[model samples]
Target: MKKAEDAQRLLRTLSTEMPEGWKKDYAGVRNEYRQAMEDAARQAALEINQTDPEVIEQFKKLRDDLFSSLSNHQARWPVLLLSEQRSVEYRQSVQAFEAKHSEFVRFMRQST
Candidate 1:
Protein backbone atom coordinates (compact mmCIF):
# COMPACT_ATOMS: atom_id res chain seq x y z
CA MET A 1 0.00 0.00 0.00
CA LYS A 2 2.82 2.33 0.86
CA LYS A 3 4.41 1.57 -2.49
CA ALA A 4 1.15 2.39 -4.24
CA GLU A 5 0.85 5.62 -2.28
CA ASP A 6 4.39 6.61 -3.09
CA ALA A 7 3.88 5.97 -6.77
CA GLN A 8 0.65 7.94 -6.68
CA ARG A 9 2.29 10.83 -4.86
CA LEU A 10 4.97 10.92 -7.51
CA LEU A 11 2.31 10.91 -10.18
CA ARG A 12 0.44 13.75 -8.47
CA THR A 13 3.64 15.73 -8.28
CA LEU A 14 4.38 15.10 -11.93
CA SER A 15 0.90 16.09 -12.94
CA THR A 16 1.10 19.30 -10.97
CA GLU A 17 4.60 20.25 -12.01
CA MET A 18 4.40 19.15 -15.62
CA PRO A 19 0.77 18.82 -16.52
CA GLU A 20 1.44 19.36 -20.21
CA GLY A 21 4.18 16.78 -20.50
CA TRP A 22 4.01 14.55 -17.47
CA LYS A 23 2.75 11.53 -19.31
CA LYS A 24 5.36 11.76 -22.03
CA ASP A 25 8.17 12.93 -19.78
CA TYR A 26 7.56 10.65 -16.82
CA ALA A 27 6.39 7.44 -18.38
CA GLY A 28 8.65 5.65 -15.89
CA VAL A 29 6.61 6.98 -12.99
CA ARG A 30 3.45 5.70 -14.63
CA ASN A 31 5.09 2.35 -15.14
CA GLU A 32 6.19 2.32 -11.52
CA TYR A 33 2.64 2.94 -10.37
CA ARG A 34 1.34 0.18 -12.62
CA GLN A 35 4.01 -2.25 -11.45
CA ALA A 36 3.38 -1.46 -7.82
CA MET A 37 -0.34 -2.06 -8.19
CA GLU A 38 0.24 -5.31 -10.04
CA ASP A 39 2.67 -6.44 -7.37
CA ALA A 40 0.25 -5.55 -4.61
CA ALA A 41 -2.57 -7.42 -6.31
CA ARG A 42 -0.37 -10.48 -6.75
CA GLN A 43 0.61 -10.38 -3.08
CA ALA A 44 -3.00 -10.02 -2.02
CA ALA A 45 -3.98 -12.98 -4.15
CA LEU A 46 -1.27 -15.11 -2.57
CA GLU A 47 -2.40 -14.13 0.90
CA ILE A 48 -5.99 -14.87 0.02
CA ASN A 49 -4.98 -18.30 -1.19
CA GLN A 50 -3.30 -19.01 2.13
CA THR A 51 -6.17 -17.73 4.25
CA ASP A 52 -8.81 -20.07 5.61
CA PRO A 53 -11.80 -20.68 3.35
CA GLU A 54 -14.40 -19.19 5.66
CA VAL A 55 -12.30 -16.10 6.29
CA ILE A 56 -11.75 -15.68 2.56
CA GLU A 57 -15.49 -16.01 1.95
CA GLN A 58 -16.16 -13.24 4.43
CA PHE A 59 -13.76 -10.89 2.63
CA LYS A 60 -14.84 -11.65 -0.93
CA LYS A 61 -17.06 -8.60 -1.19
CA LEU A 62 -14.50 -6.27 0.32
CA ARG A 63 -11.74 -7.62 -1.88
CA ASP A 64 -13.91 -7.25 -4.94
CA ASP A 65 -14.81 -3.69 -3.99
CA LEU A 66 -11.16 -2.75 -3.60
CA PHE A 67 -10.27 -4.20 -6.99
CA SER A 68 -13.22 -2.46 -8.61
CA SER A 69 -12.14 0.87 -7.17
CA LEU A 70 -8.58 0.24 -8.25
CA SER A 71 -9.72 -0.54 -11.78
CA ASN A 72 -11.65 2.71 -11.93
CA HIS A 73 -8.61 4.63 -10.73
CA GLN A 74 -6.38 3.01 -13.34
CA ALA A 75 -8.89 3.77 -16.06
CA ARG A 76 -8.60 7.47 -15.28
CA TRP A 77 -4.83 7.63 -15.68
CA PRO A 78 -4.69 7.84 -19.46
CA VAL A 79 -7.23 10.61 -19.64
CA LEU A 80 -5.56 12.68 -16.95
CA LEU A 81 -3.33 14.33 -19.54
CA LEU A 82 -6.28 15.31 -21.68
CA SER A 83 -7.74 18.09 -19.54
CA GLU A 84 -7.89 19.63 -16.10
CA GLN A 85 -11.31 18.04 -15.73
CA ARG A 86 -9.75 14.63 -16.24
CA SER A 87 -7.18 15.38 -13.58
CA VAL A 88 -9.98 16.25 -11.18
CA GLU A 89 -11.72 13.00 -12.02
CA TYR A 90 -8.46 11.14 -11.49
CA ARG A 91 -8.09 12.67 -8.05
CA GLN A 92 -11.62 11.66 -7.16
CA SER A 93 -10.85 8.17 -8.36
CA VAL A 94 -7.81 8.11 -6.11
CA GLN A 95 -9.96 9.08 -3.16
CA ALA A 96 -12.41 6.31 -3.96
CA PHE A 97 -9.55 3.83 -4.20
CA GLU A 98 -8.23 4.98 -0.85
CA ALA A 99 -11.60 4.54 0.79
CA LYS A 100 -12.05 1.07 -0.65
CA HIS A 101 -8.49 0.14 0.28
CA SER A 102 -9.02 1.20 3.86
CA GLU A 103 -12.26 -0.74 4.08
CA PHE A 104 -10.53 -3.82 2.70
CA VAL A 105 -7.70 -3.46 5.17
CA ARG A 106 -10.10 -3.24 8.06
CA PHE A 107 -11.87 -6.39 6.95
CA MET A 108 -8.56 -8.21 6.52
CA ARG A 109 -7.56 -7.33 10.04
CA GLN A 110 -10.86 -8.63 11.32
CA SER A 111 -10.41 -11.82 9.39
CA THR A 112 -7.21 -12.50 11.27
Candidate 2:
Protein backbone atom coordinates (compact mmCIF):
# COMPACT_ATOMS: atom_id res chain seq x y z
CA MET A 1 0.00 0.00 0.00
CA LYS A 2 2.86 2.36 0.82
CA LYS A 3 4.50 1.54 -2.48
CA ALA A 4 1.23 2.25 -4.27
CA GLU A 5 0.95 5.65 -2.62
CA ASP A 6 4.54 6.42 -3.54
CA ALA A 7 3.85 5.49 -7.14
CA GLN A 8 0.71 7.63 -7.23
CA ARG A 9 2.57 10.61 -5.84
CA LEU A 10 5.29 10.25 -8.44
CA LEU A 11 2.69 9.86 -11.17
CA ARG A 12 0.92 13.03 -10.04
CA THR A 13 4.16 14.94 -10.01
CA LEU A 14 5.10 13.75 -13.47
CA SER A 15 1.66 14.48 -14.83
CA THR A 16 1.81 18.03 -13.57
CA GLU A 17 5.18 18.70 -15.13
CA MET A 18 4.33 17.18 -18.45
CA PRO A 19 3.64 19.35 -21.50
CA GLU A 20 0.00 19.94 -22.43
CA GLY A 21 0.35 18.05 -25.67
CA TRP A 22 1.44 14.96 -23.83
CA LYS A 23 -1.99 14.57 -22.31
CA LYS A 24 -3.13 12.97 -25.53
CA ASP A 25 -0.26 10.50 -25.33
CA TYR A 26 -1.15 9.77 -21.75
CA ALA A 27 -4.74 9.12 -22.76
CA GLY A 28 -3.59 6.70 -25.41
CA VAL A 29 -1.41 4.80 -22.99
CA ARG A 30 -4.19 4.71 -20.43
CA ASN A 31 -6.54 3.28 -23.02
CA GLU A 32 -4.01 0.60 -23.86
CA TYR A 33 -3.78 -0.41 -20.22
CA ARG A 34 -7.55 -0.50 -19.98
CA GLN A 35 -7.72 -2.78 -22.98
CA ALA A 36 -4.98 -5.02 -21.67
CA MET A 37 -6.71 -5.40 -18.33
CA GLU A 38 -10.03 -6.20 -19.97
CA ASP A 39 -8.31 -8.87 -22.02
CA ALA A 40 -6.58 -10.21 -18.93
CA ALA A 41 -9.87 -10.54 -17.07
CA ARG A 42 -11.42 -12.38 -19.99
CA GLN A 43 -8.45 -14.71 -20.16
CA ALA A 44 -8.56 -15.27 -16.42
CA ALA A 45 -12.23 -16.19 -16.58
CA LEU A 46 -11.66 -18.63 -19.36
CA GLU A 47 -8.49 -20.19 -17.96
CA ILE A 48 -8.94 -20.27 -14.21
CA ASN A 49 -8.61 -23.95 -13.34
CA GLN A 50 -9.30 -24.01 -9.61
CA THR A 51 -12.71 -25.34 -8.63
CA ASP A 52 -12.40 -24.85 -4.89
CA PRO A 53 -14.61 -22.13 -3.48
CA GLU A 54 -11.96 -20.90 -1.03
CA VAL A 55 -9.28 -20.43 -3.68
CA ILE A 56 -11.74 -18.77 -6.06
CA GLU A 57 -12.75 -16.31 -3.34
CA GLN A 58 -9.12 -15.52 -2.65
CA PHE A 59 -8.42 -14.94 -6.33
CA LYS A 60 -11.41 -12.62 -6.65
CA LYS A 61 -10.27 -10.60 -3.66
CA LEU A 62 -6.75 -10.27 -5.02
CA ARG A 63 -7.97 -9.26 -8.46
CA ASP A 64 -10.31 -6.68 -6.99
CA ASP A 65 -7.51 -5.18 -4.94
CA LEU A 66 -5.21 -4.83 -7.92
CA PHE A 67 -7.91 -3.36 -10.18
CA SER A 68 -8.96 -0.90 -7.51
CA SER A 69 -5.47 0.44 -7.07
CA LEU A 70 -4.88 0.81 -10.78
CA SER A 71 -8.27 2.46 -11.22
CA ASN A 72 -7.45 4.99 -8.50
CA HIS A 73 -4.34 6.09 -10.33
CA GLN A 74 -6.20 6.35 -13.61
CA ALA A 75 -8.91 8.41 -11.98
CA ARG A 76 -6.46 10.95 -10.56
CA TRP A 77 -4.73 11.68 -13.85
CA PRO A 78 -6.82 14.72 -14.71
CA VAL A 79 -5.34 16.86 -11.94
CA LEU A 80 -2.99 19.63 -13.08
CA LEU A 81 0.82 19.41 -13.06
CA LEU A 82 3.72 20.52 -10.81
CA SER A 83 7.05 22.11 -11.63
CA GLU A 84 10.17 20.42 -13.04
CA GLN A 85 12.22 20.45 -9.84
CA ARG A 86 11.71 16.74 -9.14
CA SER A 87 10.92 15.81 -12.72
CA VAL A 88 13.84 13.41 -13.07
CA GLU A 89 13.04 11.55 -9.90
CA TYR A 90 9.34 11.33 -10.70
CA ARG A 91 10.07 10.15 -14.23
CA GLN A 92 12.28 7.38 -12.93
CA SER A 93 9.60 6.36 -10.45
CA VAL A 94 6.99 6.23 -13.19
CA GLN A 95 9.21 4.08 -15.37
CA ALA A 96 9.87 1.65 -12.54
CA PHE A 97 6.18 1.41 -11.73
CA GLU A 98 5.29 0.87 -15.37
CA ALA A 99 7.80 -1.95 -15.70
CA LYS A 100 6.58 -3.62 -12.54
CA HIS A 101 2.95 -3.23 -13.58
CA SER A 102 3.55 -4.59 -17.04
CA GLU A 103 5.28 -7.62 -15.60
CA PHE A 104 2.49 -8.17 -13.09
CA VAL A 105 -0.13 -8.02 -15.84
CA ARG A 106 1.85 -10.45 -17.96
CA PHE A 107 2.26 -12.84 -15.07
CA MET A 108 -1.41 -12.64 -14.17
CA ARG A 109 -2.42 -13.38 -17.74
CA GLN A 110 -0.09 -16.33 -17.96
CA SER A 111 -1.03 -17.75 -14.57
CA THR A 112 -4.75 -17.47 -15.20
TM-score of each: 0.59, 0.55
Among all windows of 10 consecutive residues in model 2, the one with the lowest summed lDDT is 77-86
- State each model's CA lDDT, in order: 0.67, 0.55
For candidate 1, write residues 48-92 as lDDT tens digits.
645477666656777778777766666666644544455566667
lDDT of 2 by residue, 1-112 (tens): 2333344444454466686665565565555655655566666666666775765665566566556656654454332342345456445645655655555555455556
lDDT of model number 2: 0.55
Q: In candidate 1, which residue pairs get closer than 3 Å at backbone N, Cα or C atoms, i.e. clash? A: none
Among residues 3 or more apart in sequence or in different chains, the pairs in candidate 2 whose N, CA or C atoms overlap within 3 Å are 16-81, 16-82
